[model samples]
Target: MIKVSVLYPNSDELIFDKEYYLNTHVPLVSKLLGDSLKNAQVDFGLASGVPGEAAMYVVMTHMSFESLESFQAIFEPNSVEILSDIANFTNCQPQLQISEIQI
Candidate 1:
């Protein structure tokens, strides 16, 4: 299982639209990839420590690499739109992290 982590840089106004993210955005993402997407989970919150430093939120997605390459194929192209929906509550660009399964 690869953990796709997204770090949201925050401002005093950083907040996640749980309703939209869980209901709308998540569903849209699942549909976009069709069967390739599975066991989806979207996290919402300000990153620890960073919140005091500046403003940082995070979303860590645990997905299978094989099932998520569809998003990768168009990552750079549709990134803005892809993230815009979630960015509605964030203050800065999100930091992303992807790790290969080590176990």
Candidate 2:
């Protein structure tokens, strides 16, 4: 399994719309990634620690590294288009990390 964890730094003005993100933005990305994607998770509405940190974090879990490959292959300028859909709500770049599950 491969997990891509994105930590969003909270900002005063950039706080994401929880329902919009959950209902719209997330589904857009998930749809692009396709049904092959699995264990898709989104977390929001959290208390901030640092003043500059984002108010939310989103973690995407692929069934395996294979899914990651599929995702990257399709990633491109279209990514920018897709990103623009949610850009206004987030201030930090998605810090994606792929890690193998040891379980």
Candidate 3:
């Protein structure tokens, strides 16, 4: 499996609407990506390992696909719509990573 991760950095100026991301944005992505998307998960950062430190990222999303090609097939075509939707939830510029899942 291949995994696509979107990481949102934490900052004092950050303005994230978790409600919209979970309720609206995620569903949109799921709908667009369709069956090629094997699985999807979202993570909310609470804190870092250090007791008084903040997490590096405020939010992280993981999406699994059968392969990198499968992901690109769907994502590339619908990228404009998917990416444009970001403004509805947050202003954070997300960092993307693609990886082969290792078991």
Candidate 4:
């Protein structure tokens, strides 16, 4: 399996619409990706390892798929619509990463 992670950095100067992301954007992605998306998870960063340190990211979304090809086949076609919805939520430029799920 593979996991695609979308990370939004936490910053005092940046804005992240948690409500819109959880309510709107996440559902949109789930609908668009369909069965190809094996599973999905969202993380709201609270704090870092250090007591007083802030979390590195405001939000992170992890999506699981059978393989990279499976993800690309679906995601590529709907990329425009999915990406365009970002503005409706927040101004943060999300970072993306794809990793092989071990064990």
| Candidates' RMSD to native | 4.1, 4.3, 0.6, 0.7
Question: Could you give candidate 1's per-residue lDDT for residues 8-94 as a string of tens digits?
Answer: 544665565667666786676666555554456665554466445532455544555452465476455555666776665445556
Q: Report how far off residue 89 is in candidate 1 (Å).
A: 4.5
How would you encode candidate 3's per-residue C-alpha lDDT over 1-103 as one tens digit per residue? Answer: 9999999999999999999999999999999999999999999999999998999999999999999999999999999999999999888899999999999
- Candidate 2 runs further than 4 Å off: 45-67
Q: Highest lDDT: which candidate?
A: 3
- The candidate that wins on TM-score is 3
For candidate 3, list the clashing residue pairs, or say none: none
The TM-scores of all predictions, comma-separated, are 0.61, 0.64, 0.98, 0.97
What would the TM-score be for candidate 4 when compared with the true structure?
0.97
* For model 4, the run of ten residues with the poorest summed lDDT: 9-18
Clashes of 2: 5
Q: Provide the lDDT at 63 for model 3.
A: 98
Off by over 4 Å in 3: none
TM-score of 1: 0.61
The CA-based lDDT of model 1 is what?
0.58
